[model samples]
Target: MLQILGAAHGAGRLDPDEIDERQNAVLRAKFVDELPEQIDDLPEGAALAAELSRQAAAASGTGTGGTARSGPAPAGRDLAPAWKGPGGEILPAHQGTGPERTRVDIMSGSEVHVEPGTPRVLSYALMGGSEIYLGDVLAPGVQVVVETYAMWAGNEIYVPPGVKIVDETINIMAGNEIGRHARGDGSNGVLVLRGFSLMAGNEVKLDPDWRPGPAQLGR
Candidate 1:
């Protein structure tokens, strides 16, 4: 199958001399998903995807066709932020990367806030350093205590009483973190939430008492 695909790549257009040979070989390598009834010869799924790849490669001047000439997919599986999937597609595996930073000028009594639609992800990231607090309040909310090695996933950050999650998703209520305990390491293996979907006029808020604290390191 591979060799046959290679031949198609080097062949520019269909050669009358090799037409019969190429067609026979391609037909043999075709993957079986659906078989044509009554028709003496028909292409299969593998043949189709391969043909598309080939055409794309040829158009790009790769001079090759089908599987052999195909380019690599974008790195990062699923096309999500945290983890990547086969062919390097970024899949929705971790929390959103938002509210990149929240800064405040206590000295001048000034505040720089990220609108609720700013940052959404609350990565359980401790790699660059422990949870960071950048803004007006010394610590508007404590970092949610989580295990650096504990099990977790990326989804909605359920902010504690003192925190607010702001991302492209719906506005998380003040005093509450929408996505709590996100996975930073390999274990943040799933995509459970794509941000909050809220009703208009209704508000979301964190409980009056819940506070964030540094997560305890696990054994």
Candidate 2:
């Protein structure tokens, strides 16, 4: 997808902002099925889309968006979070035990990338913000939980395809923006996002437009 966007930029059809959007889409795309939708409208995008379709077909010969796991499976984990920082924290492959947890304090922002072997996560945000990116490393039929708390600040969660979410979050004078892709049955893993958003704007979305720094979490 990036290659196609680069070609479009070289052809003088896409501006910088357009290229950035397309690149972000590719990076945030969690499944092959979501790939074509990200770049099927730009110049020479038809060819790109066709190429992507071929790639998807090759990847998922079973046509389930390649959700099936081949070869031996790794050991599952009920991951426990080792408290890190107020800055971005990308979770390493699953290890350890206990309840997965983390926190972000005043004026700070952080990120947690969901990988397989890890279990439920508990996160806190107070006068600060955080972001969670769900990858497709989960085992089939496995459900992972993610709990969050946001107060006087904003929080964003990005989900990919095939993953299921059960959002039992409560809000008090706060706002939330949930994207279309975040809704689904418990087919894949379950991301039970339980939290409180008070006096702030919080969001649970799917494949959000990616950006740099704190801007990635958006407003």
Q: After superposition, how far is residue 128 of candidate 2 from its true place, in Å?
A: 1.3
For candidate 2, lDDT tens digit of each residue in 1-219? 455666677788887677666655665454555667766887667875766566555655645355442221112211111122235333222322434556565688877676545566666778887777755333234556666677888777776433456668788897667655455343333566677778875677644332222112121
What is the TM-score of each predicted model, taking all chains together? 0.17, 0.52
What number of clashing residue pairs does each candidate have, in the order they appear?
45, 3
Candidate 1 per-residue lDDT over residues 24-52, each given as its tens digit: 34333222211111111223225555444
The residue ranges of model 2 lying beyond 4 angstroms of the native Cα positions read: 1-41, 50-99, 136-139, 208-219
Those runs of model 1 whose alpha carbons end farther than 4 Å from true positions after fitting are: 1-47, 59-70, 73-219
Global Cα RMSD, each model: 20.1, 12.8
